[model samples]
Target chain A: MRVGLDVGGTKTDAVIIDDDVHILARTRLATGWGVDAVGATIARAVDLVCGEAGIAREDIRSVGVGMPGQVAPGSTRVAHAVNLGVRELDVTRTLEPILGIPVRVENDVKAAALGAHALHGSGSGTMAYLNLGTGVAAGIVVEGQVWRGAGGSAGEVGHISIDPAGPPCRCGQRGCIEALAGGGAVAERWGRPGALPVRDVFDAADAGDALAVALRDDLARGVASAIRVLVLTADVDTVVIGGGLSALGDRLTTPVAAELEAGAEASAFIRSLRLRERATLLPAGSPAAALGAALVGRTTEEVLAHG
Target chain B: MRVGLDVGGTKTDAVIIDDDVHILARTRLATGWGVDAVGATIARAVDLVCGEAGIAREDIRSVGVGMPGQVAPGSTRVAHAVNLGVRELDVTRTLEPILGIPVRVENDVKAAALGAHALHGSGSGTMAYLNLGTGVAAGIVVEGQVWRGAGGSAGEVGHISIDPAGPPCRCGQRGCIEALAGGGAVAERWGRPGALPVRDVFDAADAGDALAVALRDDLARGVASAIRVLVLTADVDTVVIGGGLSALGDRLTTPVAAELEAGAEASAFIRSLRLRERATLLPAGSPAAALGAALVGRTTEEVLAHG
Candidate 1:
């Protein structure tokens, strides 16, 4: 069995999968902040998940971790995971000796992208997993491998400015896709004190609130622009929307589709691309990130041998 | 010796190269309009270039032709070559039987991208060849292979709209990168008669013409955005500016560098990218496109065996 863990800001999701990736057991635990605590949380989560599966630690072949931070290509070190309050952490060094198994770490978004590909990929071509979370970002998977570009920033489409006059991005750009569509950006712009501000904004838009309507429209526009950029730049076969905002489901996809439809109606080239048909939403509560981490643990040499 | 032909709208540039891709001989011929003439032109150009190199046709290993049309991935067929008045043409079928040499065709921009990579690639990572001809387009190369995305529309950054309220494009979008920076678009917007209107616009801008200054700024803005998009999305190590507009050399790159510098000044993240350092201009009259086509004709099997 292989083990995978999604180390998020508030929670660590763990899963044990068999050879065919069938989940043997799954569990979740509150994630701790900082390097030491997060490391401890991972250790505890692995123990709990192994217990849940009624398996000995020796039965686990390898462990893979999906972290919400910068995982450099080909390295287990994660850096600047602000949401988790982690300045830096070398996951392999911390976990390998304790677990007595091979370990690998990948960025959460990229891990999810790999999982999404395994779950829903067409078995060929490319798919971009666009994360519309606290800040928008994406991960491109081509032929089952994550496209980690030269500087390990291949899918940073959120910073691409579509509007020079729309809104200022935290990245110091005006009218970035994130400024228009990010969950945190939307919540901040809505300026309402609510745990689910984006959901609230959507609810208010349905009631014909002009401000909410505009905000919702911008969200759709930003998402549609991201889809276009992905298709035009990377020419990914599909863009699977998966993030905190995607939990809204049809409420989110419908408007984003409308925006794509509008662009199609305006341009024959855009129409030919059929962006609306290509954009899709990941199912709510999917364990893609965790599942992908397990796959990551298999190591490059093992994958080559097995496949 | 390998033969490469760059079949453009008005001229066909042909070159003969040795095993190391060094140019041994080069020649040019006026391209004829339509299918038959274009096919004939390719045959004649190859023969002439071979003769110029003092070699027999049998001495040539393969021939590659670059066309200004859509060459579907892994196909030798060229379609919708409006610039050359060709609606459709299977370049290989037309020439292979006549010349008795293996023939391959690729889009001009894509061919140029490969050539640029061979000429200036860092020997690792990725590079984007941004073409600023009558229209703006780019072709990305990773390692040594072209990144032909799923639908083969990868690197069509020209049509991506940066300003919703900017100038209208022939593709029915407003504020497209092409609309702002394309030679054709700038010429139309400038509305003055000249063989080289973009050059005139620069000259006028230098003389403090208000309209020219605005046009120049827009051009820089469009190019800068393209560079940013290439870096942010693909994380290419460098972007080489080529095509007709690059003939302006420092006149064009200077303003483009300034725009990147200004963006870096505004955003610390942008500064971190060091975009100004990454964007570069291809040398004038470089034989990259033809050389790339020659390389392309070597075929997939050949590349695997040789590399």
Candidate 2:
């Protein structure tokens, strides 16, 4: 048995699973702040899941946590995790003693990609899990392993600006896809004066709200550009959409697919890319990040050793 | 000793090298038309290089060819070499019987990437060879191996449109980086009625011709975007600039470096990419593609096996 924890900006989710990855138990709690709060929240999830599974912590072979920020490979020390107000913090060392198990921590998006692969894998080949959430990022699976680049920053496509003449991003850049496609950006642009919540922005577009429709189309373009970048650069077999914004489902995917189709119509070479065909969606209500965190340690060890 | 051949669109370059990759003999001949001419061109290169090196065909261990288009892994059957104006040609099977040695073929850009890694290798790590020439493309090396995607269409970044409202590309696309950055595009935009040769375009820009300056800057942006794309996706340690257009050298690299520097100033996240520091130039007069071709068979075998 193993344990997985997804430490997010808003919530901390946990899961305990058998050897075959069948989820034995699961729980969620509001994510706390600081190293102590973060450590306490993680400990609570681990304890609750262990109790629910009716298994002792001794039997958990590996416990993995996926959190935001730049995490050192194979260790729980985060180089920087601004969202969690973490910097150079060693969460693993703090949690292992409390939980009575060895723990590993990785970047949250990367863990989600692993989880998506483990549960809804296509057997073999590459799959890029694009998380369109509060922030935008990707978890790139090259073959069956995560492709952590030379600086441990392989899938940092969120900040890659597609439009030079577009709006400025909070990442201190102009025209980033994240600035254009992330949930916060959508809410900020169209949810002003509390007129349209981000949740109803899509429904408003469906009801023919001009501002909402334009914003949604902009989001689609950004999403399409992300797919194009992933397909053109990495040639990933599939681009699975995840994260909070993914709750919009077909409303988000359909227009993004349409944008790719339009691009293909313009270029035979771009048509060969088949970005639309390569795009996919995570199943609804999938706790992929937590589940993926559970397997992060073993997978990271195997991949780093092999790579 | 091994024989390597780079079958380019305009010329076929060949080299005979020892085990340490020391060049013993080298020659170039005009590239030919049709499968028979193409096969004959490769055969002639082998014959000439062997003669110059005072070695018999029997003494050679391996002969490899690098051509454009999609090459199957460890096989010489090209899916389609548009630059060569040929499709689905089996060059290896055709040459092996005549040469009395097994011949392997690889994509030209990919071979150039391997060549770049072999010649100016940083021991072991990812290196991206951004070929900004007649057409724009990249050769990606991950852990001393070529990263051929599931469809063998990994490094076709030329058609990745950076500007949606740019111009029409021959690939039936609008606003591709190639449309704005490739040598052909530069010539088309600025070359007219003895205005400037493609070779003199940069010199004219240096002479302060407004038109030439604009065209050159456009190319710089495209090249910069390519580096950003390569780094953001693969995070290669160093990106070596190669291909015919790379002959411009610092005139090309300086502007590209400047563009990346500007992006860094705008975004801390972009700064972390350190694109300028990672950008490199292939040594002048280097026969990287041919030499890389020489090592292609062995390297391809190792990588595909490992992958």
* Top-TM-score structure, candidate number: 1
Total backbone collisions for each predicted model:
0, 2
lDDT of 1 by residue, B1-307 (tens): 8998899888898999887768899998999988899999999999999989999999998999999989999997999999998999999898999999999999999998888887887755499999999999999987677888888889999999999999999999899999999999999999999999999999999999999999999999999999999988888899999999999999999999999999999899889898998888899988888888888756556544543
Q: What share of the true interface contacts does each candidate keep?
A: 0.80, 0.68
Residue pairs in candidate 1 whose N, alpha carbon or C atoms collide under 3 angstroms: none
Chain B superposition TM-score per model: 0.96, 0.91
For model 1 the local lDDT of residue A72 reads: 84
For candidate 2, write residues B187-272 as lDDT tens digits.
88885644335567788889999998988888888888888878887777888999887777777888888898988998887898
Q: Model 2 segments beyond 4 Å from truth?
A: A191-197, A299-307, B191-196, B299-307
How many clashes does the backbone of model 2 have?
2
Task: Score each candidate by Cα lDDT.
Answer: 0.90, 0.82
